[model samples]
Target: MTGLLTDVPVDIDRDAARRAAAEELSDPKYRDARPNFLQQIGQWLGEQLEKLLDGLSSAVPGGIFGLLLVLVLLIVLVVVIRLRTGKIARAAKAERAVFGATRKSADDYRRAAAEAVSAGRYDDAVRDRFRAVVRALEERALLDVRSGRTADEAAAEAGVLLPDVATELRQGARLFDDVHYGGRDGTEAAYRALTELDERCRRARPVAMAGS
Candidate 1:
């Protein structure tokens, strides 16, 4: 048993072992260890930030162009809306003027008829009176008297409240039309009819307003 133990060679190279260990420690691979997980994540984050800055620098011109396009479109939209609003306002004003003119015309015709009857200017009275009534009815009632509407047609559209004076009103229009268009002579009867029609229009004004 002693000889068997002696036969087993015990390697006692302590100095060599220590030298090998020191050399390994001094090697660059051993001295510079791989970074830990936290350090590696920090390095990766820095690289990504650099890449994002590069992308932003490259896209600056395109971003500016897009902004300008949006601004131009906004300006055009504002101009179009302004022009449309202006047109609408003008149309409203024109409608008001037409209505006001129609009322004034009716009053003028009534006054002219009264003046002619008082002055005994039968021919002039009949003509001026007829024109006044026609202007009023056309403008106020929106009737197209210019296309040569008959006296009965004009009276019906006038809707003058005085149905009792309908005949006299029609007669006045007929006399005016005959003398003005048909070259017939104006007379005393025509003047009388004009005066009666004017009186009827004054009475009927309230009813016309109600209907309107």
Candidate 2:
């Protein structure tokens, strides 16, 4: 039995194989056996997130439950930012002198409207052109200029002096109020309507003067 076992010649290097596997597991260069760069980054981020959550939990009342509150606050912040961006953009475009704030010349408003048209800001174009119409009537002495005079009032006052343009003035006022207060979207066609009315107001002979 001893002679047959010796002739069998078993060739096994278990110690060397074990050493190679241990080196591979410990070596940073052996990415397959060790944590890769992405895995390392994930571990670091996890540690930072844990530390942040711990700090937040200490700052607010309650323990880990505060983490849920923080998450809810983050979501609310995002929603508020989105809403402000959208509403402010709309308000900026719809703002005008008729809102009891700004005042400018007819030509100045006309130029601003033209610029708005060029920039594809149809809402601003509509607002600016409608302001131009009201200012044109004020400049022509057909309508009185006042700080709190609304679009409807301006149309009514101007219509008294220039009955020929009463229809156009009322239409322009409706467009302004629709976009500014009624939350209607301004369109290129609406802007053109105001522009045409402004041109008519420029040439209109007041009822008082037409009779003379």
Please provide the root mean square deviation of candidate 2 (C-alpha atoms, Å): 14.0
Model 1 C-alpha lDDT per residue in residues 1-212, reported as the tens digit of each score: 99999999887698988998899889889757978788999999999987865666566555656556766789999888876678775564343221223244666766776787688766666677776666765655536645435555666656455465666666766787676556676677776677667656655654545676
lDDT of every model, 2 decimals: 0.65, 0.83
- Once fitted onto the true fold, the runs of candidate 1 whose alpha carbons sit more than 4 angstroms away are 1-104, 110-121, 138-152, 159-162, 205-212
Measured against the true structure, the TM-scores of the candidates, in listed sequence, are 0.37, 0.53
Q: Model 2 compared with the native: what TM-score?
A: 0.53
Among the numbered candidates, top TM-score falls to 2
Q: Which clashing pairs does model 1 show? A: none
- In model 2, which residue pairs have backbone atoms overlapping below 3 Å? none
Candidates' RMSD to native = 21.0, 14.0
lDDT of 2 by residue, 83-199 (tens): 667876556444533744667898999999999999998888888899888887777777766776778888989988888889889999999989876778889999999989998
Cα deviation in Å at residue 59, candidate 1? 89
